[model samples]
Target: MAINPDAVGTTGTPVESSWTSKDSLLYAVGIGAGTTDLAFTTENSMNIAQRAYPTQAVVLGDASGAFANIGTFNPAMLVHGEQAITLHRELPVQGSVVTTGEVTAVWDKGKGAVVEVTSRSVAPDGEPMFDKVMSVFIRGEGGFGGERGPSGSRSMPHEGSTPDLEVTLTTREDQALTYRLSGDRNPLHSDPSFAALAGFDRPILHGLCTYGFTGRALLQGLCEGDPARFRSMEGRFSSPVFPGESLTVRMWRDGAGAARFSTHGGDGRVVLDAGRVTFDPA
Candidate 1:
């Protein structure tokens, strides 16, 4: 099905999901967490300890079979295009949460529509903890009469310029499989036939799963495994990366401890761009 131009930008079919603690920890493990280096960290350990520690938390929960929901867009024609996240209360350190997801923006991108879905995770005490923005690209599903006025994009902080620091993360061939153990059962990353139907040579990993891995790397490289010091992170998905690919993140540090980050494939094809990460006072 194709997107209704008249339906773009207007909110429809909002989905609200309430989840338990086990589901929350499952997403953490889904991103490759049980090892000492990764699990020992505060967030990972906290997710693991939740069975023991038990607090309040929330994670990515979609309101619709989002990709399949677009009227004129086929699931095979969709791709992860971008991600933006903001944390309000350090992610609950551990339990149960009610998540509300909604379509916030629909941008016309020639033959595609950039659908931005925003999910808000609220704790049981009525406190909002984290917010996530996921952008999915629907190829050949644009031009729905939406205004395509003058618009551009953000430049990478370390692009064509010197970077303050650089970090490389190597993904294992079984990475996606391991990450899936967390909670995501999307066959796009599991079944070969499903992946082929989606036009991929093999199933590709979830972009948010990658985001979680990047979060682990960034926390280790910059935050020193301190979740308390993490403020926010934003990045654009430049391309899809296969499992077992080595990812190198380039960061640009600015005055007063601000920084920007981007990652590329081994061949140096940019897979993520226009990324920025901020931290709390040290």
Candidate 2:
């Protein structure tokens, strides 16, 4: 069956998700954190406390269940188009949350369709913890004559101006393997044969993994390594990144508490674009 544009506003049952310090540490390492990032990678270090990466919230809950109401489509043809997250408060190293997911929008793009889903997580005390919006592009699922949706504006760096902050980080050859441990075990990221069938030369890194790496750069460069200062981040995935490629994140400050950025692969291709970040003013 084709996608159901009328599925917008369909909400899924609340999902209870929990994690531990070990889970957070594994996620830190999965995204390329090292000994230098002891606060996130270690639970017990001299005078260092364990901290969860702000982006960890993406994996802390299950929201994909909402997609069921969006109608059937080829799962393998769906690719992450964009992702955005808003953190209402700092994430604890180990915690639980009740998350509810909803189908927000579905846009037809002639040859394909874009489905947008939003999820909200609340702590046990009923305080909102985080909200995530994800868009997925499904090939061969369009042509139903639905609305094309809004074309967002770009957030580009100023002409003749250098980026305010730039950081480069390298991913391990086995990066996707480690990252898969964090609940996303899609064979396209670990099985070479499956990846071949998917049209990739080999297993490609998960776009969310690359997003996690970019989030690390933002946390360090803009938020002073404090998760509490990170308010929101959004970006589009323009291309696939191999597991071992180096990523360079370039940021342009947009006055206090706001910034624009992009992440490029080792070959200078824009892997993540139209990046936008907002932070709590210092």
In each prediction, how many residue pairs overlap at the backbone (N, C-alpha, C within less than 3 A)? 11, 0
What local lDDT does model 1 show for residue 235? 82
Give the residue spans of candidate 1 off by over 4 A: 5-29, 38-62, 65-72, 149-153, 197-199
Find the candidate with the highest lDDT and give its number: 2
lDDT (tens digit, per residue) of candidate 2 on 118-166: 9999998989999999999999999999999978556576634788999
Q: Give one digit per residue, the lDDT tens place, for model 1 in 1-282.
A: 557544434433434455555555555555555555543323435444442111112134444543333456676677777777777756543444556666666778787787777776667676876777777778887877676533547776457987667777777787788767655678999899998987899988777666766666666667766666776788877777788888888877765545788887778888777887777756
TM-scores for all candidates: the values are 0.80, 0.97
TM-score, prediction 2: 0.97
Q: Which ten residues in a row have the lowest lDDT in candidate 1?
A: 50-59
In model 1, state the lDDT of residue 7: 40
